[model samples]
Target: MSRERFVVHLPVLATDLAAAKRFFFCDRLLDGRRRCPLPADHVGECGPSRHR
Candidate 1:
């Protein structure tokens, strides 16, 4: 196997990296899925701006 260099930006993703990771990772949570778009430890505080 060989490694190739490829650059790709997370288009309009959450400003919060941790949240974005969770979202993109598709982590399951209560009621459906975990809160995201923000690095929130809670379930309702979906803060941060993706465009930011």
Candidate 2:
């Protein structure tokens, strides 16, 4: 009976999937802490989508 906001980010490329961001809702979820690994060409120094 309550609402919670969650944010998820995923990197999408025309050639391939670059990265993925996840939100862990429950302990029973599969790959709850899984994160999309960044590709060699991808840059992590940039912040969120706002920066790019």
lDDT of every predicted structure (CA atoms):
0.48, 0.36
True-structure lDDT of candidate 1: 0.48
Model 2 spans > 4 angstroms off: 15-52
Q: Per-residue lDDT for 1-52 in model 2, tens only?
A: 9668686666454433423222211222224454333333344432222222
TM-scores, each model vs. reference: 0.21, 0.22
Among residues 3 or more apart in sequence or in different chains, the pairs in candidate 1 whose N, CA or C atoms overlap within 3 Å are none
* Minimal lDDT window, size 10, model 2: 21-30
Candidate 2: clashing pairs of residues: none
TM-score of candidate 2 relative to the true fold: 0.22
Query: For model 1, what is the alpha-carbon lDDT of residue 24?
Result: 60
Error of 1 at 11 (Å): 5.7
CA shift of 9, model 2, Å: 0.6
Q: Candidate 1 on 1-52: residue-level lDDT in tens? A: 9667675656766778876655562223434333344434544535443552
